[model samples]
Target: MHNINYVLISLLGGLIVPLQLAMINAFRHTSGATQIQSTFFLYVGGAIASLVIALFVDGSIKPPLYQHASWWMWLSGLLGSFYILCIFLAAPHIGATNTLLWVFLGQMIFATMIDSSGFLGMQIKKLDSLKLIGLGFIFIGGLIMIYSEYRHSSS
Candidate 1:
């Protein structure tokens, strides 16, 4: 049951993504900010909020032991920036629903591979038939979303 609470919390995080994209899109339109500028501000705001939260939680914003960390761990910030920029570019053009559907599909596919392979020192979880079926369903849903968007745009 504790794990279920965590799952619900994660789901809440997922629910926020589209809203965040929409807000960012609105901010770009209203502020006349370029994609890069909006993304930069987004990260800046996130950094501030994260620092505040860290201080509140731990009583000090202490740095991690970076000396022991692998080089690839550093790629997270770059990848996150790229992802936000992509979302900023995509959400307005594709519609948030379509953009998120494709994004979620892609995430699930890659996450499954990561889980199965234990990439980045993550615990290995064997990919099973159920997981494949779940992926299949998500892929089918993405196709449906694409078709629906095409029909809506064509009409």
Candidate 2:
């Protein structure tokens, strides 16, 4: 399944998110575009780019099997829309590092639950002490980032 390729691509996507968010925020400043307007254009651009890539990579486009899909599948984009909105609002106020620290912490906790419980068709994995320790470290690091930011702002 080209697991290594998937991992590399996923890591690259993760690394790009902060940079993209920062750039989009800059556009909000320079272009006088509101966050919602910027986000709308961002998704418009993404849709066009994705279509271009799919035309090459997919070879042939086919309709998705919507009959077999759950009702929630249609609503999934709402989550992304909310996340993008929050990223635009929070990153500017909190700074990217602090904003992403909390976001990553939330993602890690929910992802651990999803992985361990086999939620949404994922393979079940035991959540062991090592996993707990890793998550704990992440939580502590996020707290530290928040505290440091608060202290600096207060002074």
Candidate 3:
């Protein structure tokens, strides 16, 4: 574990995320594919790359099938697929900045409720006032983006 440089790996992965997002939009336009289709291709490409690295660089042959995985893990994957599909379809049209704002706002709203856990049928921690204020700020920013888009489109 001490030999592993996790900080460097995380930094590289974080930097690549935005470049990958840009490529998703660019390839969608260039290849005449819908953004959702482009995103699916990108996910496939990423999976292949990750498999190669894990097999060669890490020299790991394989892990156990569904080792310690619960049904929730599979459900999470389905949720991720839908979330990615929605964002890819909407992001290009909204502009990345605006999309980011709206997505963040939505995430904050859901996250607050999830943290409270009453609505989701879970027993998670409750949110504080600070978190509520932060959620409010997120929505305010989203509204600003919407207003900006409305003004630009109308004019």
State the C-alpha lDDT per candidate: 0.91, 0.89, 0.75
Give one clash count per candidate, in the order shown.
Answer: 0, 0, 0
What is the descending lDDT order? 1, 2, 3
Candidate 1 lDDT by residue in tens digits, 1-155: 66998999999999889889988988999999999999999999999999999889989977789999989889998999999998788888888988888888889999999999999788999999999999999999888988987998899
Q: Candidate 3 lDDT, tens digit per residue, 33-148?
A: 97667767877886898889888887886764896877666686567667677767677678777765666677768877887877646678778988888888877777887898
The residue pairs found clashing in candidate 3 are none
Instruction: Kindly list the per-residue Cα lDDT of model 2 for residues 1-155, writing each as its tens digit.
Output: 65999999989989999998988998889999999898988888888888889999998678899999999988877788788898898988888998888888889899999999999889998999999999999989988888887898899
Q: Which model scores highest in lDDT? A: 1
- Lowest summed lDDT across 10 adjacent residues in model 1 is found at 86-95
How many steric clashes does model 1 contain?
0
* lDDT comparing candidate 1 with the true structure: 0.91
Shift of residue 54 alpha carbon in model 1, Å: 0.6
Show where candidate 2 strays beyond 4 Å.
1-5
Model 3, position 42: C-alpha lDDT score = 74
Least lDDT summed over 10 consecutive residues: which range in candidate 3?
13-22
TM-score of 2: 0.90
